[model samples]
Target: MKLVLVRHGETASNVRMVLDSLPPGPPLTDLGHEQANVLADALADEPVVAVCASTAVRAQQTAAPVAARHGMAVRVVEGVQEIFCGDLEGRSDREAYGVFVKTASEWADGRLDLTLPGGENGRQVVDRCLAAIERITEGVTGGTVVLVSHGGAIRLAGQALAPNVTASLAAGGLLPNTGRVVLERDGAGWRCTAWSGVDIVVD
Candidate 1:
């Protein structure tokens, strides 16, 4: 089975770099809507059987066009939403971003104990995301699944679930709006084949 985990399109909060990870987050900006349309077009050739999104409004909106293109409904899957910002909920300052980056980087390096103040630990975030993906895969086999999720949760889960993923690749770069991380799974386990368009080196 293959999983195409996608980051939702841009939002007003994204433009301002605010840490808006809560549910019912802001809707897509004009450019975001265009990006979603482009994403839908890009995946037109894929054998997309199921389209899932987090509880967030932005994620659902981003999945709408893709699901419509495949003649499927966007399944609202829990546990795949953004990492809660906690203390840095709405701040866009360098300090806030620094804390976020440091904590997420630690998680990528296998330091699951480290956590953002008032936010979830790496273990909690990764576990839930992985479980959600597991649930999706149980129902769909040998087919492509599209999951619209947030950048933080996507990166964390990608690194944790895919042994081929390097800490640098997982934490070094940003997952732009509508970016994708592709994964493949078999009896052996799950492997990350691509990150944001860059092909990963499977070990």
Candidate 2:
């Protein structure tokens, strides 16, 4: 099985650098909708078998074009949304940057219990993402699938699953809007073949 993990397109909050992580989060910015179309175009030639999106509105919006192209309904999976920002939610983007880097570093250092004052720790967020992906992939035996998610959560989960290549990237949260990572299952295990292939190289 192959999994195409895609970060959702940009949102209104993204432009202003605000930390909006919960439900009914702002809709896709105009550019965000354009980015979503680009995502669909990028995967136009792949043998996509299923489509999944985080419960967040942004993710669902990102998955719309791709799901419609494949004629498959978007599967809104639980536990795969962005990490809750806690007290950081609704704060200015400039203010959230430091905490974002700090908490991410803590997670990389194996301090998964650390989180912002009101947010979820790395362990909680990564565990949910992993479980959500597992549930979706378990039923898939072949072909590619797409799971639209947030940048922070995807990289965190990537680090958890593929620490060697992802560690350095995870330390800084390198995924951009609509960034993509490809993972393939070989026998009984899974491995990342391409990570943020739009720019970053894995080999």
**Per-residue lDDT of model 2, residues 84-182, tens digit only:** 989888888665778877888888777999977788999999899998888989878889989999888888887777634456666765778899977
lDDT of 1: 0.92
Clashing pairs in 2: 17-93, 86-118, 86-119
Q: List TM-scores for all candidates, in order.
A: 0.97, 0.93
Candidate 1: which stretches are off by over 4 Å?
A: none
Predictions in order: lDDT: 0.92, 0.85
Give the alpha carbon lDDT tens digit for every residue of 1-203 in model 1. Answer: 88999999999999998999899899999999999999999888899989999999999999999999999999999999899889989999999999999999998888988878998889999989999988888866678999999999999988888888889988985799999999998465789988999998876
The model with the greatest TM-score is: 1
**How many steric overlaps does candidate 2 have?**
3
